[model samples]
Target: MSLGTRPAANAAERADNGAMVLPGRSHLRAQRAVKIGSLAFLILALSAATLLLGRYTVTIPDFFHIVAGADIPGASFIVMENRIPRVLIGILVGGAFGAAGAVFQTMLRNPLASPDIIGISYGASASAVFAIAFLGASGLALSGFAMAGALAVALAIYVISRRGSVAGYRLILVGIGFSAVLQAVVSFLLTRTDINVATDALAWLNGSLNSSNWDRVTVLSMALAVLAPAVVVLSRPLRGLELGDDAAAGLGVNVERSRLALIVTGVLLAAVATAAAGPVAFIAFLSGPIARRLLGGYRPLGTAALVGMVIVLAGDFAGANLIPGVSLPVGVITGVLGAPFLLWLLATANRSGQGG
Candidate 1:
């Protein structure tokens, strides 16, 4: 073949390859959309069911009427004041935990970097336990203590891990160490406290929606309103950082600044959620990975949030009714569900020599 003909043929071949790649990309995007839509539908269905199906079942018509401001005797108070707040707080706190987990896992590029696995949740739990046992804090004051504790732990982790740049392995190691110490602190406090206070603290630590109320819902809503936007904005820099610090810097990202912002934002998200509903077990640790799997390894923060809501709402329902006579904490159900997955993940990682 002539040289000129060869060049034209190669150009045609490149065009054909590009055409093939476009369709694959488009197909993947369509699949992702479908998966995300399905997740949203599941969340809605779970929320509705949670509201309707319980010891005192409310009919659909009655639920709508109650929502429409009708006073339908017992149903009105049960649906409006009790069930509604529980559902709302579940959704809000679940989303917060999911988003926080996604940020930590993605930013650090480590699956074990979850707030609960590290010291953040332990921090919140320990602080709140201390407040309950000694200071006799309750309501908003207890929540405030939780938030402060999470932030303090996060700050300490950052300072300890920051040498030149924050290494993911170093951060995770430091956090795990902190987690052990804080867990010990929590246990000691529970032992030293009065039995009544210890019982209350234990319930909170187990993560229940039993105390869900309009006040808790409102606080969580306000915190997410401010923090969610920060997460969206920082996500761009987060993506860059995923490509490594030098590469992100080359891409015009302020690596240290962006990382710090992300850390603070993630800590606050996890903190508020823990404050509102306690550290509801593996929701944060599990949500991101679940969403990513559904999206074929593409992590969408929003999808993670929705998956979190579904897990919480569904878990809460099952926890309440799974045993005929006894209601369990939502965290207990989640812990049971998530433990197997965690073991599977560890096994898979070990087989691939990534468990270290």
Candidate 2:
């Protein structure tokens, strides 16, 4: 009788503990849901503002009418040709950068492992500049060169860092070195080009959305449609990978294969986005950390994507309208915003003894 009662009491205690724990878990889930919803709402609000509150002031009714195919002349041309493409490309590019950055940071277990910091963006920039100055490449051809550059740099970094396994710090150090060299190459190319060509290349290097078009929108949309799903599928293995290679292998993950896939996917994501937007300055670096903070240190890729979209849209809006008579490039605005954040991150890392 005593033994039976003791077993029953143990079961009751276990149930009570579970019941006590569940509420906290439920509360955290609820909070994350709220944060995600808030981010979605913010994106919508920004999109609406970008569309409706520009130089021409598109009314809500006119906006709906334009969407419904009611051709309103000036409004239609501006909305359809300029504003809509810019918003669409910004969202797609930002989401791609954010997802890529989160994957790198999470997979490598290092905040400094963003594509931009590690020479991938510089690689694309250098290639695009070379294409412009020497190959006379433009449009899709320029984009292709940029993509090839990012992939090549990523492969080189991986190969150099892969001694036994790629350590995050070693890869980051190698990438930084590559970035310096590529940056110098870009500078040399710009100096050697004709003044007119240099002017055009400089504009692109600054990452403006003034030339956003439907073609860019279509290409980026298609790329993301394919890559986003792949990222989603690989995210499970990515989470396992965060637990270290041996541990992930213990859990039946093909550590090397999974890591390779992730690197390629992340590189491609950053590549496509750079191809579309000229490496829009720090969207990749900033999105992951921002999302992690918002979600209480839990890194959800979707949330990071949303955060990236917000950053780009907001930056573009500010750049276009902030100085009244002068329009700044989106990259300029983002760089200004990101520089302080970068400094803060480095300082915090140093204080925490993670600076190395």
Candidate 2: RMSD to truth: 1.3
True-structure Cα RMSD, model 1: 1.2
Reference-based lDDT, each prediction: 0.92, 0.92
Question: Which 10 successive residues of model 1 have the least lDDT summed?
Answer: 347-356
Model 2 Cα lDDT, one tens digit per residue, 1-356:
58769989999999999999999999999999999999889889988899998677999999999989999989999999999999999899889999999999999888889999999999999999999999899999999999999999999999998988887788999999999999999999999999999998999999878889999999989999999999998888987888888888899999878888999999999999999989899998999999999999999889999999999999999998899888898999999998899999999999999844
In model 2, which range of ten residues has the least summed lDDT?
347-356
Against the hidden true structure, what lDDT does model 2 obtain?
0.92
Q: Give me the displacement of residue 285 in model 2, in angstroms.
A: 0.7
Model 2, residue pairs in steric clash: none
